[model samples]
Target: MPFSNKVPTIYDPRIGSPMLDAEEANFEEIALKSLGGFVLVLNDNGEIYYASENVEGYLGFHQSDILHQPIFDLIHSEDRDDIRQQLDINFHIPTSSPSNQFDIFAPPNSKYLERNVNARFRCLLDNTCGFLRIDMRGKLMSLHGLPSSYVMGRSSTGPVLGMICVCT
Candidate 1:
């Protein structure tokens, strides 16, 4: 009998690979097709690593122009301080508590962007992006009594713009 990924991963090791639901390996494909929004995966330092085609629509700038830029630059100036506080709160929140994980503090001077525009700010390292992900969930903000229009997120550059930074 041969071991499956389960041997090291799941209880069923000798049997054939468990078939995932129709939604198995196709999650990315399905979501990508359905949502049609940009998915940017930033490193702890906030550099743009994985940006989807939808990024252009989300940020107005082309992927080529934004690569290696700090995610913090796009944030509106007004929200920066509040966003910074929220990021601090997020960093301190316990990892096990998902409820404490998100925030709703919008960036300064940022109303829901009529058009996407992002700017990058350099960090003290002069080479490394400073932003660590301050994970913000839009749905969570609404659940916490924040209005749907209120922006939610964090930036490494400084504070946030329109996006709300929910602090603990």
Candidate 2:
């Protein structure tokens, strides 16, 4: 089905177990898109499995262009160590632990612009886009009993199955 901003209702079809009912799901999808945001579903190894279409609106790169790429490839090299540190923290958190949030900021410095994987980052569109400073807030979740898409993963592995990464 085409992605929509409307909330999902009871009648909406979800491939596996549903996280939100039809209406709520639709509403969230819509809200995220309306806010010029998109979602990414990544495995423990930091490989992106899914990239919502709205990513083009936010990053200027099409979803197709970034699919299957390691998320770190898009990050500034100077910031990679920090990202790794954060990912390590996420993986160490047990399933029973409370939800945690992390903030990663990339300034529009030469270091950041020099590492842009896509040329689009060279164009300063706005504060939110291009090499201007991008702030990412990610929630690291434990996938003990979620959908197979999250558990079995695109490539089956212990760490990949145990982690759920949602980035906006």
Candidate 3:
């Protein structure tokens, strides 16, 4: 995959699984092209797995700059510990529940250009891959929706996927 200034990194796809199906990849492309939306996938450990072509619209970052970075690095510190606790506890108990309503403010001097953003986080992998997707700029969170999160991860079959939480 190519990299850009908005995202400083990218990684090889997971070794075992087959590449995403054509229909799935096409669906992602449609999403990215429509609604001007972007997509991102983090591993159980929070490393960047894949990002949609339009990721910059939401993160003020490009997929190239995002690879290998812990998802928590993008989160606001004030909310990290509490969100972490929830993700960890949720893992042990096995619930993919939504969090209480809240917002994660854009960081000062942050990479993202648009201001007044927010997102609705989803625990996508509780049953299989075990990761999170911060849904951005949809009718989901608000007009300026942007999703981001941290995944410390857990073990599933073999991967050391941990825990994670989204700030807004």
Candidate 4:
């Protein structure tokens, strides 16, 4: 038998590449077609620092347009307090060692309602874009080497990275 050489890697048919360059990966232009949805990164300050290219399909705002904007801006006002409380609680919970896996808590009746949390919110696009509800799913972890403000949590040393999925 002839020897064959191929390195296996994580694959995404939508992106056509296992690993996207920093710029390409951050771009959410193709997020609309992805069943898995797009990725988002929020700093501990609750500001959006990174949004995949596809974010526009969900929120009608481009990634660049929303950068540095508070995540609360996208949330419906009625839900802000509840979501803020949940975020505070999440920020205080200590990470388990050995695994260091963080949790992403969503509001009641959310798409991934595995646990019971009182937080609930609707994600709306711009005023002119109309009403649209977006479901967010992601994890929280310490991300080093980011801007100082991103890591502004009371207890955590480094900036908290929220890797999330924006889904309709």
Candidate 5:
């Protein structure tokens, strides 16, 4: 099934285990393809849990090759620290807050905070291409109690991260 931007609806019948609705599965694929990028989901430890198939076209690595691997492993060494810092939840917490609690500029200590990153990633298919520049936009996802079927690989019982990366 293709990925969709909508949260897949779990359909439960009296005779079967819950399953994703077929209609919503293609939304993610359409969204990603339109953007000309791929999606990545990572555990708190930064291990890859899922990578869209389009990654092969953009980064030259098959999805299987990077699954269960550290995302940092594929990042250019010089850019690893920067990417790590941007993804670090602690780094986003504001040290001071505006006098008004409702200020939009005030960073919220919430799981939904979004992160943006620009970095260079190693190209596995062609070493001659060296590293390719990538821009990523994503948000911290709280997946506690998320059904195993909703995510790829192991079931996530804690917070997970997700990103959409485009090559430039």
Candidate 6:
């Protein structure tokens, strides 16, 4: 008998490799579990790129069902606009003035900017539950080195915005 050697893959073969390795994925799962919230990644346009697996446990929607979908579709209609505004970089840009001219052009080196929002999200698990209020605290991150293939709308080289939403 001849021996055949092949490497085993952790993700679905049909979808190709995910950005995270098995160890990284496990670590993320543990961290999110401890925080008692699920992580959500969204593009500048509010399209969902990645969501932690724990989302199904908290929000009742599988990761596959929501990926590449507009996040607004899952939010309560009344709170959608507020979430949109918070995610928009333009909304947070500082006004230019003589004293703040340098500040406007040269911001801090931090990749993340603080973002906090409270909104009601539609619950898919139980009709009786309707919409569940969620508090999201996260950062508006600069998608500089992020893989474009992992992103929903843009290429890797361009200036892209992403948010890491921890919803509890």
Off by over 4 Å in 3: 1-28, 82-159, 162-168
Give all candidate RMSDs, comma-separated: 14.9, 11.8, 17.4, 10.0, 8.3, 9.1
After TM-score superposition, the amount by which residue 52's alpha carbon in candidate 6 deviates from its true location, in angstroms, is 0.1
Q: Name the regions of candidate 2 deviating beyond 4 angstroms.
A: 1-29, 34-36, 89-130, 143-168
User: What ordering of candidates by lDDT runs from best to worst?
Assistant: 6, 5, 4, 2, 1, 3
Q: Please name the candidate that would achieve the greatest lDDT relative to the true structure.
A: 6
Give Cα-based local distance difference scores for all models.
0.39, 0.49, 0.39, 0.52, 0.67, 0.73
- On lDDT, the stronger of 2 and 4 is 4
Ranking by TM-score: 6, 5, 4, 2, 3, 1
Candidate 5 regions with alpha-carbon error over 4 angstroms:
1-29, 97-112, 125-128, 144-168
- Model 6: per-residue Cα lDDT at residue 167: 91
Clash count for each candidate, listed in order shown:
23, 11, 24, 7, 4, 0
Lowest-scoring 10 consecutive residues by lDDT in candidate 4?
111-120
Overlapping backbone residue pairs in candidate 4 total 7
lDDT of 4 by residue, 97-137 (tens): 22245433434313322212222233345554444545555
The model with the greater TM-score, 4 or 6, is: 6
- How would you encode candidate 5's per-residue C-alpha lDDT over 21-120 as one tens digit per residue? 6666677677778877778876555667778888988888998999979889998889878777765555565558443343323365453357778878
For model 6, the run of ten residues with the poorest summed lDDT: 1-10
lDDT of 1 at 29: 52
Clashing pairs in 5: 3-28, 3-29, 4-27, 4-28
Per-residue error for 35 in candidate 2, Å, reads 4.1
